[model samples]
Target chain A: MRASAESNGGGADDDAAQVMGDGRHARHVTLKDVAELAGVSVSTVSLVMNEKKNARIAVKTQERVNRAIRELHYRPNALAQNLVTGTSKFIGLLTDSIATTPFAGQIIHGAQDRAWKQGYVLLIVNTEGNEDIERQAIRMFLEYKVHGILYSTWYHHEITLPQSLKDMNTVLVNCYSDTENLISVVPDEFNGGRTAAKMLLEQGHRRVAFINTTVESPARTGRLAGYRRALAEQGIAEDPSLIVDAEPTQEGGRAVAEVIRASGATGVCCHNDRVAMGLYDALRNRGIMVPSDISVVGFDDQEVIAAHMLPPLSTVALPHYELGASGVDAVLAPPVHLDDHRVLIACPAVHRESISALD
Target chain B: MRASAESNGGGADDDAAQVMGDGRHARHVTLKDVAELAGVSVSTVSLVMNEKKNARIAVKTQERVNRAIRELHYRPNALAQNLVTGTSKFIGLLTDSIATTPFAGQIIHGAQDRAWKQGYVLLIVNTEGNEDIERQAIRMFLEYKVHGILYSTWYHHEITLPQSLKDMNTVLVNCYSDTENLISVVPDEFNGGRTAAKMLLEQGHRRVAFINTTVESPARTGRLAGYRRALAEQGIAEDPSLIVDAEPTQEGGRAVAEVIRASGATGVCCHNDRVAMGLYDALRNRGIMVPSDISVVGFDDQEVIAAHMLPPLSTVALPHYELGASGVDAVLAPPVHLDDHRVLIACPAVHRESISALD
Candidate 1:
């Protein structure tokens, strides 16, 4: 417990009156006053307010106390009570762009749904990737005595943990730390990659080409790895010529159509839905038809893109909802390994209209 | 000043000590303890903490008290201090989907930026569009003594304002009331329509067509109104045959391509970018070149579609950022008229490669 020695100079217990003199807030109903009005002790008032039945106070006395409370309209200050109990029914969510990124809102939505079910209220602070503001927000959360904190980022990336977050109970969402000293809940991008490849392979395409994003992204590494693992499981040799590189946009996909066509691959797997859509456009412009001339698969089942694509893109989902809800669960449960706890949720394949079996 | 009379049974202000007896939380530092450590009075400690140099305490004595505060870590309880000042450096943001809608996060971001700059903290509650939850959330905000409230919706719609919100300082964002009782910040969709049509007309387009959403949506009414006004200004007789209806989606745009072509309007305006993209898709399938054989325009410059379109859609932007930022400004300012304060922000034109000038 973070506490200190109790030392005080004797004086008339006039703190409430002094605060009332300041006249900035509505006059609060203190326990001391409730006890006097009910002709009971301060402990009796506290017990009644907390709804402790063990005190065995008379029904009549309880009714009188309840009437006094109603008349005074004394609402308990959870913050003040948290000082004595050291338990706060509050969770603080720290995010970089969950508030600004439309897709990322699901993270907060999933977390809030779980937190509310557990009788905890969620307070979110969007730090907007500003380290100074992050530190300031953390201090504010500490002052509020939050039970735990969920630190999240907009995308899958590695982050330097804020030094101020060292001692607090926290869970990382959609990002990780090298130290492995904090509980991390991130998307299984590698699995998603495999899933995309599997979706294509299951459709009976051996010469499925992989259109990759920029080489530097961790997503690229993980997803490519998954794609290879899936191909290997089907007793297929890694085709060095089949793996192609493109920017992670529709134009990038379109620009690489020559490689896609020259490979004579019956199908293709794009880094994301955007790239897949771009490939679709490129093929259409080249007088090629999807699922008739070739099949295509994508990752990140972004609704606006994947669901609206002409053929309705067959893709791998990011598991955003699960990642968020799992982070909240992991923080509340606080696994036995504590700092070393890591949870990886699966990214399932969403089959729409883009993929077709070649056999 | 929503306050009540003080009523209670008081002994020696044993509230703090009794709460400590609950054996849960860390013992918090109090003003009495600070006064004793500083060898001054409790009032003096309060004044120093409140930074009231006018309390007449000697500078030397004040420094001593400050040192004592640092040593004791006597951070004031903002919740308690707020009682006297009536000003809480806190803002409450209530929404149906700020955390869930990607675009709506910008509203919070804009509001939080303003609030943080003004030394206020924002606590957000996502009510999930439930009336009971909305009411429950409002009660919680009231209990926290928030300085102001911002109620927002996911999309623009007329809302039955919650009865519980009448007394609190609140401003509606991206929505409106039938009664005009609350300050509302809504998108100027009508002007956006005018801008879209005007952009094409300015480029020497005489036969301009308007594709609209269902006539029920305020967005449709507003945008179409603007389109008609722009045509009327140019003395171009409104072509009733040029007006068409479609769902607000790509498919809807694709389905109406023949009508767009048959209307023989060199320049066409669809309800939104998605519909424009659909039209682009439909036209592409027919080998109709955008801005070559025909010119195209759209609204709600959704980044996913607009920025990435083959021709990069030329469309009208929804003023989401300004609408959110303005709501924060309005709530904090509490307009002189209080009720009936309406702010209409413009939706500007984002010109990309889609719209072409005629010979």
Candidate 2:
């Protein structure tokens, strides 16, 4: 790649080797020498430095290039680009919670990976589950003059955003806003629910139960709607008695099983994996065998519960990392119109041993 | 409490009230007035604002005080103290991941709560699980002139902190440095292991098994030590035959369970709740009844796994929130001597129905 381009420096391969005139110390190595030392083209060096995908370079060649760069202490001039753009090369990430859930981490990881590849860094602030803190965190982001903002909600809740940010470039993650115009990247909970229900239906189960929490929660409501939609598509009438409202707790799951049993449901679609875990307890307490007596499906596909449940829970998997990454992406390059505000990430159903064909 | 304090708005209270007059805003309604309106004292108001314990103030009085403050539109000039000290009223929170896991969010919540009470706001940077991103994050924090830095690792890894921060006040959470004299607040994995092991032993189980991942992992090593320590204290020999290495995955748990069956161990302690979940699947696959046939305990108390496991998993809880809160505290306070730099928080065990006495 370097051989194709006209030289900005003198035409030698060692063009980047000159020391500074100030004589304070040796001159810093640049991308040119790294390419030269690794016997690769300059574009190859850029690709390696930028971590760009679709490179036809061999793995061994890439490793050698990286080793040469590391050994020479070559630094990419990302700061120069920041100077030209008058941007801090930073994106502000505002979350209701930062350290407690695995979903947030996955999202952050996705965003961060994308941001790094795109030459941007993330500035994160936790709002401590308070609206006031959330407002203040945004103000702080503004003061730092971040290029963009990604606001991530812990759960689906109505957020009263600060008016100061009304004109700012922003995106919401795993949340929706009443404004309708704002960009939002959230897990496709409705689709996830529909998928779970479809899977159970395909197994020849008609008497399906929906174990969920309060209807007041947007997530629960959305999933319920999706479950109903899926059932309707299959020419099955909604069974009100099969719906159970359980607290989003283990005890709640265990208690809700009584309702499931009373409704004579053969299949159960849990609000989340946590609820499904509790269902396991309630099922075992009554000497019911999963898949045989009752097939269970959960949502969120939490790493801990999905792996550990007695039969291994089959659940709807939320792409946490993708959600986070997309949230940041939306902020960086939002769709132009309010009608295109929603970024729906696919939530695939993970097939574990929790569900089997109905006999 | 307010009535007495309003009558005694002497030195400190008066100073605080006057501080609000720096701008055109009127001497903001002092905490004294709120106390007076609530029939409490200024000190009582201070206690509430600081979230201090040992307060005997009635809930009604607290609500009254809060109402008065809201009605008066009182914005506390608490952050002024930070400006005087040339310290940014903002603390820098550096995390490797912000959106993937729940632990970081809980820790951030705890720290944010404590910091807000102390009149500090957090400026968050998400490194997105990249070492280069982390370096850049630290540089940004330094450029922004943050008062202190709280560096949190997403997973257990030896961290190479930014060299520029050698003189700055820094604290590490959930990760440690190879360098001496740096303060770190990490989960008490050893204590957690001991807690889980002791609980299982107390349930009268003698034939206990251990399923862990890589021995190189500090968390696994610490937990293994605690398990052995607990066994030694109880005069029980540590059985090599009962120890199995399982991948930190559900599939690994299934493979380990076959070994567990061969060893004839009646009780099991897992490296983490995730591994324990795998064990659950393995046990169910073999048609073994938990507690009746074998009792299992896990570590990390991952919410989903702990609540959802068939019997409700009994696991050692990591003090993630406390670790985050304490990390902020350490950075804010004077540095402790490197030789004496050790802060260990207690990890308590949560008892569920998973374990039963082996009589």
Docking class of 1: incorrect
Evaluated on the second chain alone, the candidates' TM-scores are 0.83, 0.74
TM-scores for every candidate against the unseen true structure = 0.84, 0.66
Residues A1-359 of candidate 2 have per-residue lDDT tens digits of 12222222332312111211112112234456678778898668767766767777788889989998877665455332332222345677777764456555666667776776666667666665677777777666554446677878766555766675555567788777876466788777778789889889989999999987764666787788889999999999997888888887667788788888888988999888878877886777677888788999988877555756677889998788788788767665655444556788888989989888975
DockQ (CA atoms), all models: 0.21, 0.11
In model 1, which runs have C-alpha deviations exceeding 4 angstroms? A1-76, A337-340, B1-77, B83-87, B337-340
Give lDDT tens digits, candidate 1, residues A286-329: 99988789999888787567888788888888877778788888
Q: Over the true interface residues, superposed, what is the Cα RMSD of model 1? A: 7.0
> What local distance difference test score does each model get?
0.76, 0.70
lDDT by residue for model 1 over B70-94, one digit each (tens)?
8766665655455443245667888
TM-score of 1: 0.84
Docking class of 2: incorrect
Give candidate 1's fnat, 2 decimals: 0.25
Model 2, B1-359: lDDT tens digits are 22333454454334323322222112224555666666778667766765555787778777887887776554443222221122345677888763346655667667776776665666666665666767777765554446577878765657777775554567777788877457778777777778888988998988888887864666788888988999999999988998888787666777788899889888999887777777776676677888788998988777556656677888888777787788877766634454436577788888898898966
